[model samples]
Target: MKLDKYTVGKRYGKALFELAIEKHEADSIYQDLLKLREIFHEVPDLGDILSDVRLEPYEKDEIMKQLVSGFEGTIENFLYVVYNYSRMNDLLLMIDEYERRYDEHKSLLLGTALTAVPLTKEQHQLMEEKAAKLLGYEQANLINLIDPDIVGGVIIEANYKVIDGSIHKQLERIQELLLK
Candidate 1:
């Protein structure tokens, strides 16, 4: 039987997260995972090389060894496990799963603030506070996303909900009212 990418990610990522928590290395693992994700994104072909069937396991191990040279054992072991199972291509999915778990562990809501322009530091802080309050979370991590078409105001996308306060949405609502 074969597992889908999402399942594979959930299994491996959850295992790793649990291990990190048990070892009291969650923070370290989190930082390393972020760096590892950056590396994979910047050099996508690295995953292909690791997952290539033609390469002997030893060869692949050597490459992974180099990649995890300075990283902690948890990361290296996790990479090897992923490679051995031929799930190299789903590394990003695994990272995302791990991040989701991390956020939950920290009681955080990760959200986006979409606006016509970039948010100032003060505005970003305020949005995070407001998002936390509106979403009923103690903490929120908001990333500012600029969408010029919004035409001002802001749209908050968080926790599978969209708070559309943008001028574009307001205008559309008015148009619908007029038509009615």
Candidate 2:
């Protein structure tokens, strides 16, 4: 059977993650990956350019080197491996899987909190603590999303479950009850 995207990403990510751990640069490598991810987000077409077939391998390599000039050793090698294998399109997935594996190893949970307005640092800390307690994790990596459409309150997503405490959802529930 053909392997899936997730499987391929996980394999590459695991190999890179192990290398990072062995080199005692796990945190640094993760930070580099975060920066790389930011670049991908800022320039959506960068991925397309890297994966373009018309571009020579040396040209693609040069671009990738410039993009990750600050990174060294294992990270550089990992990029070359992905490029040589023509897996540039899976770069984001690899980063995501690498983060997932790293977090798993560190006993951390990733969560998202959506609110009508931005949360203060104190609010973020409190939410992280609450999420950790509820999710039974040592700590949580919380990503805050400001969504005015939520109206008020917060929506917490953790471990594939959604705790919809938003006023918009509450109002919808109440309206459904009234109609019934």
Candidate 3:
């Protein structure tokens, strides 16, 4: 049966994460995957080539060999297993799921902050500290993004939770109260 990328990611990603934890190599494997993901992002067609039906088996194998050249241990095995099972297209999704698991294991939180203007380094550090405390994580990393519509202040989204402190949101709240 054909599987969606998310499903493929969960199954394969969970198995690989469990293995890495068992071998006490989760950190190394995570680093390898980070680099692999970067490369895949850099060369967008790499994944397509692996999963392309038009490519000869030998040609794909050669490419896979080169791709796995520097990646050893669990990650190397993972690449082969993904290709052997024809799951190359789902590789990035699996890596992302693995990253989520790793972050959970490390007590890290990833989030985004929407603001009208870019945050200064000091503001960023302060926000990170606040997010970590509020979210009860050891560390919280936020990607600061500009949204002129926010009008000012910040809207923090972390682990599906939103802390909307933006001026736009406050104004909307006030307007709702007035309408009521």
Candidate 4:
């Protein structure tokens, strides 16, 4: 099928996801996307090079080929599609959205957990289990963040939903109530 811009991105992402799953390389693909995101940010001219209409399609393809030479197979194809469609500007967003969809399809929730201190491995595991149970997901990928400003307690964010259990937030709510 001829895919639209969004569908093209979804297709690219789905293809990569399937390949990664089959090869047990999902983590590698995720890391590759992270690296690509960083490279795109660091090299300001790269985007222009990809999107430059002056360059013939073959020339652009060559440039992309060199850029992704060291990437995993799945990511290599992802870059090829991005370059072929001249969607360099949307590359990172497309990959991120695709990953999000892939995670959702696997019954996994990607989220962040903020705490006053770093969590122990046991605590992390417990939190992951609790989050999965509460969110009704089979798995949870919880990114941990340490924020002393939180004073104590934890805050969790999943799928744009925030569960605030932080002392800082509680204090703010109390202060507001007192003022009222």
Candidate 5:
């Protein structure tokens, strides 16, 4: 029976998650996902090939086997299931969703913080404390990025919300107020 794209992807993710847990290889699977992302980015044609409906299942399976030959055991099985179900096009998304679910299972919240300059160790620790309190989560995986356009201050993004305290935004607001 054929599954829809989302259904296939979700099923693949769930299967991978379970296998990773059973094998105590969640970190390995996550690393494999990152490697696969790089492979997909470097080989644009691979996506086209996977998304092609003209390919036979056996041919597709062969291609997937070659592509994922060196991956960790859990990742190999995950890729097999994805290709068998003709859901290879959703491979990256499914892996990402799986990683997110895994992180949630570990009680870690992912966040992004942007600043005009690199944060000091003290600042980072303070940010973590504040973020933990605000998010009501004991742990966070905070990704920091430098955005000089901000001029100063920082922006914290989590769960689709942006907490902007950037000097660029402040300047724009000031300019707007002055113009009125």
Candidate 6:
């Protein structure tokens, strides 16, 4: 059976998360993982270099060591293992999975709100409150996604569901019905 990247990542992430929690370093480890994600985003080819089979294992280890030198203990050791297995390509997925699992454990809900333009602070807060209530989460962390293509309205995604209030979606639905 072939496991997808997410499945593989989730397994590793869950293990790391559990270890961090046991060690009382969950928050610190999660922060380090978030930093790693930011680094990955800033250096798009870092993943490629880590995952590139053409590179010798030693070279990959050196790269991993340099990148993760600041992190100690669990996170550093975890990165070393990931590099040893040539799974650096899965690092981002693993970080995301780790964050999601951590949030679930903490009773926090992370969501995204996509709109044609940036939302005002008041609008954002109101949306977050509504999303929290709708999802039955004590609090909601909604990140704003400015998408001009949405054409107006907002699309809220949380708890594995998408609530599309975008005019673009509305128009598409209308067009589909008319065509039918």
TM-score of each: 0.86, 0.72, 0.93, 0.67, 0.71, 0.77
Per-residue lDDT over 100-165 for candidate 2, one digit per residue giving the tens place of the 0 to 100 score: 888977879897999999999999999988988887889988899999999999999977888899
The CA lDDT at 155 in model 4 is 97
Q: Which ten residues in a row have the lowest lDDT in candidate 3?
A: 85-94
**What ranking of all candidate models by TM-score puts the best one first?**
3, 1, 6, 2, 5, 4
Winner of 2 and 6 under TM-score: 6
Model 3 stretches astray by more than 4 angstroms: none
Question: Model 6, stretches more than 4 Å misplaced?
Answer: 114-119, 144-154, 164-180
lDDT of 3 by residue, 52-168 (tens): 999999999999999999988788988999999888888898999899999989999999989899999999989988988998998999999999999999999988899999999
lDDT of each: 0.89, 0.87, 0.92, 0.82, 0.79, 0.89
In the predicted model 1, the residue pairs found to clash are none
RMSD of each: 2.1, 3.5, 1.4, 4.8, 3.9, 3.5
lDDT of 5 by residue, 67-172 (tens): 9887856677667766665567888778777877787777777888899899998897788678767877777767889989999988889767688889999999
The best candidate by lDDT is: 3
lDDT of 1 by residue, 1-180 (tens): 988889988988899899999999888999998998999988988888888999898998898888888775888888878888788888888888889999888879998999999999999999999989888888999899999999999999987899999999999999999999
Q: Model 6 lDDT vs. the true structure?
A: 0.89
* Model 4: lDDT of residue 19: 74
How much is the lDDT of residue 141 in candidate 4? 83
Per-candidate total of colliding backbone pairs: 0, 0, 0, 0, 0, 0
Q: Which parts of model 2 have CA positions greater than 4 angstroms off?
A: 1-4, 115-124, 144-154, 164-180
Model 5 score (lDDT): 0.79
